[model samples]
Target: MEHGIVTFLTDYGIDGPALARAVEERGLDGLFLTEHTHIPTSRETPWPNGPDLPRHYSHTLDPFVALGAMAAVTERITLGTAVSLILQHNPIGLAKAVASVDHIAGGRVELGVGPGWNREEMANHGIDPRTRTARMLEHIAAMRAIWENDEAEFHGRFVDFDPIWSWPKPVRVPPVLIGGEGPTVLDRVLSHGDGWMPRRAGLDEIDALAARITELQTRAADAGRGHMLVTVFGVRPDAKELAAYADAGVDGVLFTLPAEGPDTVLPLLDEWAALVA
Candidate 1:
């Protein structure tokens, strides 16, 4: 069994840095926040969580900005974008941001990203939502090239460029956590993601997802790569639920709170901390 409790995902606004610090002060090992460029005024896609997406998603701050502030304040805690909308980003610039944060954190960053849900948001970024999965894969590949090589070039359909140099690299390329749980998403996790995030589900789903990750790890090892991390998001603190996750091979479980300010955030940390201890 692992020794940590959970990571966090929030629509954190102004106080993102303080929220992360509070988590660390409470003895949590990692803190993360979600990213969305802008929430469309016209509601087309149903909110993944409930009847309607909360208003805070529309008012949130940029994830990298929050993570950078959090990194400066905390010593050993890992910081990450709970799920950065990958398809919305320019891969080269996005790669630079990831590397910069990794360097600032002294290598305590985890990357959790998704293909994205809003069609308008993707179109706005000049990315086609239809090919999001493919784009995400190539984006990861391109980033790895930049992170691992002194000068690298990518020529994929979605992300490509001439061999250009980028520097200060990263201490260790931050862990790439693919954020979604479908067959197509799983295949990508098996292929490129260093971890799988089974976000927002029942305890039953946790067990099954963990099994799938373990199975994928076996397959990956056979393929000569090690793709063995399973980081579940929005965990509830029932011992049975967590034990179930551990039995299923989960590396970590991150919880979701309705908000991230001290009011909603602090007490929950105290409550969740004792469970892991």
Candidate 2:
């Protein structure tokens, strides 16, 4: 069980199976692939995490391909697209891919998604930056329908699809996580998602958000959904800070290894294992 998993999020461009084997050998609980379709050298929007955050934000193999490879080799470790460029994908295609990956991994997959902010990136994929929020919400709705229904359909301003058969339905529907921090996004998370993952929303904010989420969960009890999880992002190795989050109702702490290579990564994994051990 994931008593406390030190999950990995990386721009890893290695043999996924071999890497996963190493992780399993050293005893890690899960592997998550962080997303970045590309990094525009000339960008206007500041990086969300911070100016000093490393370039691991980009420059890596596709998360899905890498996670799929990891799934092929690992017997029990969980796999996920920690946060995919969900806005850029066709809902049907993504639903199918997620189901396929979950099947290969014996039904272990969590779809962490967000309203992507990079303007150039969204434009490259022909998605209007102005409508990203609405687009993402519709995409979420459509993806859920495809996952939960044999003959799925959606009728919305942006995602109108006729009833159609979808196959090899996931043995279990993957958890849908909404990532982004803001009141509107929080409302969306409370109403639509299965979990809330506001990555890089510093510790203080996370503590406050945790309280707000509890209030929302209490309201949702009327609708029969009070078991949503809260997961921290880019978690550091400070035990006190980590404990603060745990005290705030967080269910997981997901972090990314530095972008350099395994030398920098394996030590951190060992350190993390020691902490949770």
Candidate 3:
């Protein structure tokens, strides 16, 4: 299985170029950055992970810009967004940004996308949280149209645009990984995404995750789509657990690094790299 790292690249954390170089030097396969455009001060939407929202959520550097910086200093490691908030951005601009980064990375870019969880944040973006899923779908479709065509036009409930030109199309269409573990996530992965990126609940959930992978692959085969990739996010560095994931057909596992400077982060990377080796 592919071993990678995912972290919220924040202003307070290790900078992009240094972190990317460290990850590559350690022989990690990929480095994925998390995104949060801005955090609303209302604190209305409870954070899923804990009672208090983490500082990194509000301090994250823009993923595309950071990834671009990372790409300039790294040669082999893949760069990606762990889950870009699709409903919060304009698709045309995002497409160009992603494609530009892909060019900088020499085609090593993956886009993991989802409808985000912060209700107030979405509201601030003029997005209705209830309609976020539908909006996310439309945004991705519109972005894909822009990426794949010289002159692209899209007319949908959320995204509508006339045929226009956008330059630096991705070295290739970056693989779209649908991020969510909801009941309907598989359907979205099959229909619109190139892969399934779900968070690991715990070791106990491995069996169920395996079952879901089987279901997704079976459905994909029936639909004539082959080999759906499954990458678990926020994975702990446990050898037995990783073995179980590989046996269960997970394509990759991303270990999360806390948003900290090299003093705290680099040692962990070395440990995880040793584990991977």
* Best-matching candidate per lDDT: 3
Q: Whose lDDT is higher: candidate 1's or candidate 2's?
A: 1
User: What is the clash count for each candidate, in the order shown?
Assistant: 1, 0, 0
TM-scores across all candidates?
Answer: 0.92, 0.89, 0.98
Ranking by lDDT: 3, 1, 2
Which structure among the candidates has the greatest TM-score?
3
Show where candidate 3 strays beyond 4 Å. Answer: none
Worst-scoring 10-residue span by lDDT in model 1: 1-10
Assess the local accuracy of residue 274 in candidate 1 as a C-alpha lDDT between 0 and 100. 77
Question: Over the stretch 66-147, how does candidate 3's per-residue lDDT look in tens digits?
Answer: 9999999999998998989978999999999999999999999999998999999999999999999999988999999999
Off by over 4 Å in 1: 1-14
In candidate 2, what are the lDDT values of residues 1-277, reduced to their tens digit? Answer: 1322323344453355666776676666667767777877778777766875365666667777777787888887777766787888888888888888888888878888887778978888888899998898888889889989988999998778999888767768888788877777767776678887776446667668667767766766767876776666677767777777776777777765555556766677688777766
How does candidate 2 score on lDDT?
A: 0.73
Candidates in order have lDDT scores of 0.77, 0.73, 0.93
Give the runs in model 2 whose Cα sits over 4 Å from its true position.
Answer: 1-14, 49-55, 200-206
lDDT of 1 at 77: 79
